[model samples]
Target: MLLEIDAQSQTPIYQQICNQLIIGIATNKLQPGEILPSVRQMADEIGVNMMTVSKAYTLLKNDGYILTDRRNGTMVAAKQSLDPPFQARFSRELELLLAEASIHQISETMIQEKIKQIYQKFE
Candidate 1:
């Protein structure tokens, strides 16, 4: 897996890692049961603090994107569907995004088309 981090960006390194990994899972670049690099290994590979990678992995774990066990270390999780809390969180985030787009004067049609394009990526 490849992760690109921009030191100058507004987003934190941990969040950048989380975003990319989530994208990878959604796009099937990372598959269920596939092993992920350990926090130390990922830190060494990407030249970041181990804690940062650990935080990203922790967030993914909390969000149900990954699994951890003594035998497996860390791996992608096979989520059958979104649970209630997750669905609510996603709805709120999407609502905020749409609000921000409207604030920027992005048209409804454009927002919908962009949404469609993103949905297609998951498919």
Candidate 2:
């Protein structure tokens, strides 16, 4: 895993770690069933406190994004189908986003086309 931390960023260290790891998993930069570095080792590499890395790892585990075993350590878990709560969250986010876009005079087609362009770049 390659993690770069910006100590000057406004985001908290643990949050940066959490967000990057999540993106790594979603983008397949980090593979499922791959063991993550130990929290102490990560802390040493990032020059942050061990507790910060531990907190990020804990958050990932709680979110069902990773599994931690005594022998195998932490590995990415299989991606799960969206649960009802997550589906509701997605709907709420889309509604809020559309409302904001309307206020800004942006149409649905404009938003969707922009998203497609961004997704294409990723691909």
Candidate 3:
């Protein structure tokens, strides 16, 4: 779990932290049941306030990306089946990205190749 925070970014610190953790889980860099650092520990490590880390953790937990237990602390949750709403959101986002690529004059073949490369990384 190497988490980096950009103090100057327009995004909120907690959102950035949540995004990175989500990426880690998606890439399998953080496995299911892997324990995450305590909120205070993560705050100290990232040089952010404990509240920021807690907010990120809270978001992750709410999204079913992580779990918290009184005795076991926090760990990655097992992957769940994607619900219809999640699938719809994913489709919309992919459409927006493809539209942007098209606007930038990225060829269809190139866009497909990039998608393939990224998809392969998850494997």
Candidates 1 and 3, the one with greater TM-score: 1
Q: Write the per-residue lDDT of candidate 1 for residues 26-106, one digit (tens) a residue.
A: 999999999999999999999999999999999999988999887879999995585898889889998999899989999
lDDT by residue (2-114, candidate 2, tens digit) is: 78999999999999999999878877788889889999989999899999999999999998999999999988988878899879988999899999999999987999999
- Each model's C-alpha lDDT? 0.93, 0.90, 0.93
* Per-residue error (Å), model 3, residue 117: 0.8
- How would you encode candidate 3's per-residue C-alpha lDDT over 6-115 as one tens digit per residue? 99999999999999998898899999999999999999999999999999999899989999998999999998797997899899999999899989999999988988
How much is 10 displaced in model 2, in angstroms? 2.1
TM-score of structure candidate 1:
0.95
Top-down TM-score ranking: 1, 3, 2
State the weakest 10-residue window (summed lDDT) of model 2: 114-123
lDDT of model number 3? 0.93
Q: Global CA lDDT of candidate 1, please?
A: 0.93
Count of residue pairs whose backbone atoms collide, per candidate: 0, 0, 0
Pairs in clash, predicted candidate 3: none
- 30 in model 3: Cα distance from truth in Å? 0.9
